[model samples]
Target: MAITSDDVRHLAELSNLSVTEEEIEPLKKDLGAIVEYISQLDELNTEGVEPTYQCFEMENVWREDEITEFEAKRKDLLNLAPESTDNQIKVPKVL
Candidate 1:
């Protein structure tokens, strides 16, 4: 798994990075080393091991949905706003 200057250039272009001529060689060497190190995982033996999706136990803890009333009235909330119409807060148009 050797990385070349062309490969580095192409990767830079794909990632929207600006790479100079001096940086291409260094990037190629670093990327090649990373690929070689990652390829070492092929030597691991996991013949009878079960694939685990999560490291810890997870369960859905759900509660019943209930509506609770607030102490403030609708008119009180509307009055807090600088400008309101039809019991709704008025805001400036975005566009």
Candidate 2:
């Protein structure tokens, strides 16, 4: 497929990119070559091939959940705060 300057400009706009005047021609040629190279895949013959979801053998490994306790106490943590009221941290109001 032949890629034109207009096609490049449209692609640039879709991709949120700003393309200069000098870059347009080079982009057009490069994009055209890429499309042509990918088009060659149409000639492949895969009549009896099975569809593959993953290339490797993989499975989800699960472990039992366990609860752990920390040494820090709630009162000690509250005392470290700069400002606290009614066992809760106090901060300036935000809209």
Candidate 3:
């Protein structure tokens, strides 16, 4: 898991990162140590352990679906907009 100067340079180029030459050695050492620590996980024994994606069970607390009628003002809805023509709201082009 020891990352060399060449490895750092290759990684930087792949990621399109402009890394100065002085920063390469420190980055390589840091990344190499991280890989070394992650590889240590292989030493753990998880035999007979059931695999689980999440720790908690998920359920949605939602209100019951019900329909109700209410009076709406058409003029109030139209007046909320700054610009309207022929009962249609006008918007500027996005693209």
lDDT of each: 0.92, 0.91, 0.88
Distance from true location, Cα of 89 in model 1, Å: 26
Model 3 whole-model lDDT (C-alpha atoms): 0.88
Query: Candidate 2 lDDT, tens digit per residue, 17-63?
Result: 99899999989999999999999988999799998977788767687
Q: Model 1, range 23-89, lDDT digits (tens) per residue? A: 9988999999999999998899989999997787866778779888889998998999999999888
Instruction: Name the regions of candidate 3 deviating beyond 4 angstroms.
Output: 45-95
Error of 2 at 40 (Å): 0.2
Ten residues in sequence with the least summed lDDT for candidate 2? 59-68
Instruction: Name the candidate, 2 or 3, with the larger lDDT value.
Output: 2
**Highest-scoring model, lDDT:** 1
Candidate 2: lDDT of 21? 93
lDDT of 3 at 74: 73
